[model samples]
Target: MAVNLDKPQRWKEDVARSVDMYNQWFLNFAPGAFRATRISATVSVEASLLATSYLRDIRPETMKKNPSILSMLRMATCPPIAVDRLIGLAGVNSSLVKAMEKDNRLPVRVTGDLLDKELQKIGEIIERMADPDIFVWLARGDEPRQEEIHRAATIVADRLCGAQANPIIRNEQEKRQLAKIKTWLEARGYNEAETKARVDFQNMEPGTFSFRLNVKVRDNTVNIPVDAVIMPITANKGDLPVLIEAKSAGDFTNTNKRRKEEATKMAQLKQSYGDNVNFVLFLCGYFDSGYLGYEAAEGIDWIWEHRIDDMAELGL
Candidate 1:
C-alpha cells in the first residue's frame, strides 16, 4: 500500500457517508432501538430532526453491531458520582410540557402511572451521563434536541470497541457459509476441475509454488470432487517435497494422532502418484476460513495453509 499522509481525513469522509446512508434508510424502523428512546415518548418533533442530522454525520453501523451502550459504560469503570448526577437529571417527572419546552429542557409526556416507571429508568441513564467521560451520555447529550436513534447505535459501537478489547469473532456459522463463497467463485470463471490441472514447469527455481483446487458437484453418474492440492516443488531433487493438508478452522486439529494419520495419508498419496506427486495434500476449506498451516522444507519456508480470507475479500 502506498503511504498516504492524510489517511485520517479520508477515513472520516467514508464514515460520514456510511452514517448518512444509515440514517436515511433505517431511522424510523418501528419496534426497533429508536422506539426505546426518550424522543419517542416526548414527541420532540424539532429535536428529533436535529438529532437525525447529527447522527447522519457519524457512522451508526458501529453502534448497531455492538452491544448496548449502557452496558459498555458500566464496564468502562465510570465513577459513582458521575453516574448519580446523570440519573438525577433524567429522573425529572411530570414536568410542565410547555414550560419545559420554553426553557429548552427535555419535554416530559403525561402518561399517568406508567410515566413514573419509565422516568425512573431514564433518570438512571442520565445519572451515568454525568461522568467526565462525557461520551457516556452515549447516543445522547444535545439537551432539548431529540437524539437520532441512529446516533445511539454508533455510540454503542464505540463503547464496545473502546471497552471490550475482544475480537468477538462474528459469523459463527462460517463453516456453513463457506459454500456460498465457492459458488460465487465458480460464477467468476474459477473452474474447480482445473485445480488438479498441472502444467510442466521444468527448470523452475527451488521454493517455487503452485496451487490447485478441485470441487465436485452432485450428479447421478459423476463422483463428487472434494479436494484441493498446493504443490511447492523443491530445488533439491534428492529432498522430498513437503505436502500440507489445508482444512477449515474446525477441521484442522493439533493432536499428535491426527498429525501421524495425515502423514500416513500423504505417504500413500506419494506412493500412488510417484514422481507426479511431488507435493500432494488435501486443501479442504473456503477461501476465508483461516486454517492454513506452514512447514519448512530444505530451509525453504512453505505455507501449506490454505487461506480463504483474502480470496473471499477479493470476491474471487
Candidate 2:
C-alpha cells in the first residue's frame, strides 16, 4: 500500500521519519541524500512548477534556499514501475460493460477517434524518462536510491490511473498509440512484451522457465507461466554485468531481505549457469525515502538497485 503523503505538512513529517529510520538502521554515513529524496518524493510538478516559493523550512522545498550537493540525488518525478501499476486500471469496466451489453467491446465516452488524448498523455509522460530535460530533474541527488526512483514512478502511475487523468480503451488504434507513445517516452516496463508463453526449460526466452529456485520457491509453483525478461542492458563477456530483479518504492529498505533471498537463488543459478553469473537484485525506487524497508539479502555480494525518476542521476 502507498503512503498518503500528498500534503506538504504530511510530506515533511514523512521525510523526517524516513531519515531517522535510515540513519539508525544503516548506522553509517547515510549523508543527507535520503532527506533530499524524501523532499523530492513529495513534490508535485503541478504544484511545484507554478509555486513561486514554498513555505520556509519545508522538507523538499527548503532546498531552494540552502541547496547542497547531496540533495541533487532527488527525483523530480515518480518512477516507471509505479506508473505501470497505475496503468493496470486502463479501460477497467469495459469487459463487464460489454458483457452486460451483450457486445464484445464497449464503446467509448470519447468516441470518433480510436485513441483518447488523455490516454496518450500517459504515454507521453512515460516517454519523458528518456527526455533529457525531465530525467535530469528526477535524478538530481547523489547516489539516488533505486527505491526512491521507483517511488517517483509509482506516483506518476497513480496520477495517470486517477479518474481525472486516466481512461481505458481497447481499440486497436488506441493500443497502437499507447505502444508507440510508450516506446518513444521510455516508459518503464514498456520494454516488456506480452505473449502466450510456452512451458520449457531449454533456456529459451519465449518459453516459460518452470521449476523453482531456493529464493522464489514459495511464491512460484513447479510449473508456472513466466514472461520473457527483455534485456534492459547490453552485455559482453567479462563486463561485470548480471541480471537483478527490480522493485518499486514501498518499504524498500527491506532490500536486505531481497539480497538474502536472492543469495539463495544466486547459488542455485550459479550451480546451473556457473559462477560467471554474478548475483544481484535491483530495488527500483527513489533513494530519498530510503529503501522502503527493503534490504539486500544476506550474503549477497553485489546488488544494483536503479530508480529511473529522471536520467540526470544516471549521468545520461
Candidate 3:
C-alpha cells in the first residue's frame, strides 16, 4: 500500500480534538465518577470469591501452583516491595521472577535488614489475609471492614482479569491492523502471500548482521520483529521489500523514551538496509505532539499516522 503523506497532519488535528473533548469531560464529570459505587461492583464477585478462597491457603506450595494469587496480592499492595521479598523468602520457582522481569513488574531491590523488615510487613499482611474474621466480614458484606476486604478483593480481581484479557485484546488489535493493511495492499495489486505478518528478521537473515539501536550490550543482540513485511517478488523489484512497524500506545505519558528508541531503530534499519529496502512506521493511539517530528528527523522513510480506529484509512 502507498503511504498517505497527508495523514499525519490529519491525525494531529484528530488528536487535538480528542484531547479537547477529554479535557471537557474530565473538568465536568470524570472526577468522582465511581466514588459512590462499591469496589465489588467494579469487579466480578465470583472471581473475588475464588481469590479469597485461594488466598486463605497461601503456602509456598500453593503459591507455586497458583502464581496468580501472588500476582493479585502484589497488585493490591502499594510498591509491592514486601510482596517481592515474600516471594523470594517463600522460595517460589525462578519462573515467577523471570515472568516479573519480562513484564517489567519486578519490585525494588533491597537486601540485608531492610529486606527482612519488608518480609515482616508482608507476613503481617498475609496473616491478615488468612484470618477467619476478614473472611467472615467479606462473606457477610459488613460495612467498613468489608470495604477494606472488598478493595483488596477488587484489586486481585482486576489484576487477574487484566492478565487474562490484555493478551487477547492486543492480539486481536494486531490481527485487525494486519488484515486492514493486507486488504489495502491486495487492492493495489500486491500478492496476498507476499505480505506476511509477524515477520522476525532472524528468520529472514540469520547472523549476517545485527541491527542495534539504543541497545547497550555487546553480546545481547535480539532479533527485531516487524509487524508486517512485504517481500520482494523478484531480485530486481525496486518497489517491494517494505518493512512495516506498527505500534499502538495506550498511554503517552510513559512512551517518550520508547518512541525515541523506536526512532533510533528506524534510523538503524535505514542505515543497515540502505536504498535496497523501505521502512514504514505506522503509529496509532496516543502520541506526544513532537513524536512525528522526531520520527521524521530520525530518517524514517514513511509514516502513516492515524487513530486506532482509523487503521483502514492509514495507507489509502
In model 3, the Cα lDDT at residue 155 comes to: 55
lDDT at 279, model 1: 34
Q: Model 3 clash tally?
A: 0
Q: By descending lDDT, how would the candidates be arranged?
A: 3, 1, 2
lDDT assessment of candidate 2: 0.32
Best first by TM-score, ranked: 3, 2, 1
148-174 in candidate 1: lDDT tens per residue?
334543444344333322122112222
Can you tell me which runs of candidate 2 are displaced by over 4 Å?
1-194, 199-228, 231-242, 286-316
lDDT of each candidate versus the true structure: 0.32, 0.32, 0.47
Q: Candidate 1: lDDT of 236?
A: 54
Residues forming the 10-long window of minimal summed lDDT in candidate 3: 207-216
Better by TM-score, candidate 3 or 2:
3
Candidate 3 matches the true fold with a TM-score of 0.53
Q: How far out, in Å, is residue 235 in model 1?
A: 43
Off by over 4 Å in 3: 1-53, 76-125, 129-155, 159-175, 186-221, 232-240, 250-255, 305-316
